[model samples]
Target: MGLRHKKASAGGGHSTSGISPNSTNGTSGTSPDISENRPSWRRDPLEYNLDRSWDINAAPTTRVFNLTSSEIQAAPDGVLRPLFVINGQFPGPLIRVNQGDRVLVNVTNQLSNGTSMHWHGFYQNGTNWMDGTVGITQCAIPPGESFLYDFTVKQFGTYWYHSHFSSQYTDGLVGPFIVHSPEESKIQEMYDYDQVVLLQDYYHDLSAALLPGYLSSGNENAEPLPDNGLIQGTNFFNCSSYDSDSGYACDQNSTRAIFNVAQGKRYRFRLINTGAFGEFQVSIDNHTIQVIEADSTLVHPVTVNRLPIHVAQRYSILFHANQTTTNYWFRARMNDYCFSDQNPVLDTDVRALITYTNSTSDPAPTESVDWTYALDTACEDLAPSSLIPYDPLPAPQVDITYPIEISFQIGDFALDKAYINSTTWVPPAIPTLNQAVAGLQVNNANFTTSGVSTAFDSSQLVIDVPTYKVIDVLINSLDEGAHPFHLHGHQFWIMASGAHGAFNWNSYPTLNMTNPMRRDTITVDAFGWALIRFKADNPGLWALHCHISWHMEAGLLMQFQTRNDIMRGWAVPSDVLALCHVK
Candidate 1:
């Protein structure tokens, strides 16, 4: 099945409105009139929530969203720089829909560079071209052009959309995409309010300006450090930290994000880490949070004082407003131990205000005490074994095993690059999907291979599944840094993971096949290994790569061509094909 483009205008579907602070009982009341004339960075908190009158059991309808990408100057953390924003918002607007609803997003690229929008964690089963991956699915939406991303969301949980071209998303161009389902009715009752909490590692310079240095010879594997951390795209940065002649436009008027909650009400905060490099250890002072979902996979509630979240990963936690009516600190501390080098001007501890009375005052140190538990010293995800899927679904028996090793090497010109089994991926001139469909339709032998395909150049790592089967991917990281790997179009059951060493063949039979944590993104610890299994049921060219903006740009990516029997019949939409031929 190919993607369908609708010719209707961009404003008819359910649109979001601002949340009124005067509302009681956690239900939104009298939405404030929001328009383009308002401050660009200001977003309505209610825009992130499912409408109170929305009927979860109602029929799914097509939701149309319009986004304009442009370059603007803004100081998310006191440092002014050129940023790529959607609809003038640093963090893009929310695209909320119900499960099975067709989502049509019109992305108008006004920047001088090419761009594409990847809906993170969506199973773009039949509409693979709409996956919006630059190299694996389709070409980038060229400068001053528009592309309509059309796909139906099959899963319901917290997901996001971001630019898939190079490190463009690091500069901005990211936002939340949420899908609600009737199946969530039971979980909905557990909370009276719902909102999104965006956590990102902020950089003072544009990613385009920093890329050359990181990719320069002799630089080794030292990733550029973040200047600050942000909560909801805003944070307090001390302008005095910069020298008077530092050449930066620092504004001391910047402030931290504040989230207000009513007493005795439970709120669900869906946290998404949209950063380039840093992993955040998130916590709310005096609040013991319960994690209900991870990477769009709902799980049995796991309570913890702090949450360790890596790049591109998401978690939804339930927080109860049972404490005193006062402001408390919500902390997202970057794991500096994971950084290869220290940044002197960086404040690793990023904070936001969580108030019960809508007071914006900073919490007194003695009023809100942090949990005594030590932060995570290692860069990795929360243990997979500790989280069990809410719905018990046994993993299918594995039919094959594919082992791949990852490492960063300084080769040739002494420039550093990442590799997956001796192959460092670079975007092919034509997307892999285009090449596969064209070759498969003509019965080319190179495209029909069961293992790795030779239809593309050496830089393209293409593993062809070709048929339906259950597969286990053993990902062993040889480098000394944690990597959060995201698999497009599918969520896998994490059979086993370790901080160090190889998968034990002796322990293979003892693995948990029933109800293991299933998620779209997982962090393989530094020099660690992870064995994940998934059924090769989705027909398309699916990308499996590290979600870190730096790592991915360094050639750490691969694609799986699954179920060619169905893909062989695809006819890519003309609009998607037109992007490649743009002058």
Candidate 2:
């Protein structure tokens, strides 16, 4: 299977005025699109081992990416239908390692279509060449070919990886990559249990997959209905489905989806939001998640019943399931409200199960469960910098990190249309999204963006910004939905965010220089705006946008170029730049 250039799709296209529709009317139902009622996803696992190789051609095929679920699925179900997985799982696989350990992921694309992998939120460090960005840092490895991604695991905490080229992640192509603290040997005795719980939303209506086809087709009607929430892949209880094909009822539950736990143990729940475009509020049987880390950076522990995460963000929480009973139910939910909508009554709550004990019930339906994982405490501090291998260089000019107004003035989703530089935005033979990457508003109003990626020249930037140079950004959305904007290679502190150009910068606590949590992504409110900042340190072309694949494929992205160390000079490798094949 091959990656095709953007073209007209059966789903829909983008239009210049507003969201237009083709086959999907944003409403799907034998009845009216049920905004209140929803679905039950399967219990699944997102796990995998890092496959390493110096020789790409000789890479071993031990199924590097393992989607810990126990479901039976076949890839390329028909002709070019990709299964949204690398090795038979929604989230491609899990990559785990110890701090300071060298990491190498020999990606082998065995599925039916062409794809590219992203090391989401991972500090590219000295290995800027390995940071995954299709058609920019490097081109997608063609089918029948493989690539060896080698890098050292410098930072510890929670991180993830996903598909970068297209919206395959929406169909379920994602996974977790964990780097344990070098201090793990000492911290091991602090807890008696450890488990990873990742959350993600899915679009199971296979035939209706949209947005992506519209990248080139410009058809808005083809866009699938907005699917707002999701549960952990491994939490939904085993629900039996009835198949009339053979006039029989059998258990169709995936074997790899079930989880086992003990009654008394101090467990660590590595919480993640892999939502291509959703924010989730997680709960676990009425228990508050004692959060230990944010975006993989350790912080003073904080506790809360619920904490929200945008696309590509991660959290680590600790809990003691020391319940007297043998079983305890756990749940996680994604709300309809984001910076955009702030209150989308139309959004549904997503649910999943977590059992503290496997003991069975006496064949009777029973109680309700409500719980969420969150930070236990917080402090003013900055994470100690790891010994990144890059040479120290001079910093770039930090001109005005001034605020920019957002205007979702692009094309309509229902009609294949758009505008670039105030003119109609047309798809390039090889599309370059820069022209359409500014001031995106989703629903024909003043809105904010979570974050979007664009490109910039090394020459046009301000160098060596003085200390305390604050950059304020105003994102406006044109669409009715929210977008989680993430910045590659850097972390920004939140200033403020709200729908319709509203913000509370003076009221919110400013991130202190001490104990600052490094993050890669921050979600913009639905039809809202987000105010965030970070020291412009890293020098490279970075992407900023919603983690949601479909929105990105549409146009919710842009770029930034920062020179943290000016003396280091432009270190992007020669061969890696060639890989991008930029004319």
TM agreement with the true structure for every prediction: 0.94, 0.66
- Show the lowest summed lDDT stretch of 10 residues, model 1: 1-10
Per-residue accuracy of model 2 over 1-583 as CA lDDT, tens digit each: 0011113230112111211111212111111121122222221232221122112222122212222212234321111122455454444445655555556566766545555677887767666557776633456555555666766665666787876766666666666777665344444444455555667754433422455464543444233433334443432222222224633222333221223445555656777777654456665564556766667655545766766655677777777655555333444444433322232222334544444444333111244445323421211111223211122222223335444332234345444432111222221322121111121212211111122222222211112221224344455544444455677766665544554456655654442333333456654543456656665555444565555565555444555544323313334545443433433
Model 2 earns a TM-score of 0.66
Best by TM-score: 1
Candidate 1 segments whose C-alpha is farther than 4 A from its true place? 1-38
**lDDT, candidates in the order shown:** 0.85, 0.45
* Residue 224, candidate 1: C-alpha displacement in angstroms: 0.9
Residue by residue across 1-583, what tens digits does model 1's lDDT show? 0001111231235543321221234532112332222355655454555444556666767777888898998888778989889887777887777887888888999999999999999999899999989988888888889998888878898999999999999999999888888889879889888878889999999999999988889888678889999887888999999999999999887777778777898889999999988899999999999999999888889999999999999999999999988889999999887776678899999998888766668898898999999988888788998898888899988999999999998899998899999899899879999999999999998998998888889999988999998989999998888899999999999999998988998998899987889999989888889999999999999999998888888899999999999988888889988888998
Measured on C-alpha atoms, candidate 1 has an lDDT of 0.85
Candidate 2 residues lying further than 4 Å off, grouped into runs, are 1-82, 88-90, 183-190, 205-208, 212-223, 226-257, 336-352, 360-368, 371-399, 410-479, 498-517, 564-583
Task: State model 2's lDDT.
Answer: 0.45
RMSD of 2: 14.0
